[model samples]
Target: MTATTADSVLTARAVLLDMDGTLVNSDAVVERCWRRWADRHGLDFDEVIKVVHGRQGYASMAVLLPERPMAENYAENREMLAAETADMEGVVPIPGAPAFMAALAGLRLPHALVTSADVPLSTGRMAAAGLGLPDVRVTAESVGASKPDPEGFLKGAAELGFDPADCLVFEDSEAGILAGRAAGMRVVGVGARAAALGPTVHVDDLTGVRIADAGGGEFRLTFG
Candidate 1:
């Protein structure tokens, strides 16, 4: 997203944030963990990652390792992946995320984090990424389905005390964008070249977005 793309036009009552690429730079951890899993299971690495990124563990495992009994693969892979990621370093905050989240707090705008990660991983990684917790957060455990299904974002909107239509979501992946739209919310595309998917607005990072109190129950957000 350009520096002056739509700073003047973007505003919302509530914001829904996707966790991984949107809020934090966990791509290194993800790539390393998944690559190891692929090697162990004799599966295709790139294909496995595409199916799994921003998705539930069991679901991704089922899609990538279809020949095994899912229950077994899910349990084992979850343990292995978690172990590998537990001591992860170099987990950095996404550009602009800290400022964006802090601005939300200053405006007191209702917001929630909606993530495909399980509870343990989500909390751990968010801390590692140096992000403050949101007022409401929906993890993979809270939903029956994953991103591209609308369940995660729908649950997040409810938890944050807003209708889906009253909220705007920020996401980096195509699946995350699809989920936000399915939930009837406008989406802001994040990350490298994610704008090609057509988010309501795009910004390079959270640092480029700001919020101000618009008074009388409304908040204003600007993209720069």
Candidate 2:
């Protein structure tokens, strides 16, 4: 879907961002890795993709292969992580993501990156996308549970020193949006796919988002 502006304005003391689809355009690499893994497991690639986005590798594997032993899932996840981290081809910033990140830094806003990717995978992808790591990064290694569990988002809010209710989350997947909501934070869906998931506000991309200091350590997010 083409990009567009959001109708509602959102305000928050801090922001929590999802990495993969929301900021970094890593769909090519992600799909490639999952497709290879699916082939190895004799599973349908399309079905694997459907359940993989916005989730930890092990979690996705669990959902896709519920009958498999946890040890097997863990071993496969490690292999997938190694393959993904080694393949940075096609990784880039989502439209307007660079500018949006700059705006956050310019406004001196408190923000955290909550991702299902492990440290190596997340760092490699972010570097490939030309984005530096955020001050607060909640990766798979940092959380016991992943997206759709709320643990990551809640941890991000706490790390940023904001109440869950005072944080705004930007996510581009159903699992991530649900996680944000479960954390009691208002969420701004970052793309058409995410918007369809029913976040509090929907934006085509970060291009139309503007943040300004709102005195008293608050920030006003103006959505187009």
Query: In TM-score terms, which candidate is top?
Result: 2
Worst 10 residues of 2 by lDDT: 1-10
Runs off by more than 4 Å, candidate 1: 1-8
Q: Write the per-residue lDDT of candidate 1 for residues 114-218, one digit (tens) a residue.
A: 998777877888889878988688987789887888998888878777777778888998888988899998888887746788888877787877677777766
What TM-score against the true fold does each predicted structure earn?
0.89, 0.95
lDDT for each residue of candidate 2 in 1-224, tens digit (9 for 90 to 100): 01123546777889999998899989999999999889988999988998999998898999999999989988888898999999999999989999999999988899999999999999998889998789999999999887899999999999888889889999999999999989988889987778679888888988998988988888888887
Task: List the candidate 2 regions with Cα displacement exceeding 4 Å.
Answer: 1-7
On a 0 to 1 TM-score scale, where does candidate 2 land against the true structure? 0.95
Single out the weakest 10-residue window by summed lDDT for candidate 1.
1-10
Clashing pairs in 2: none
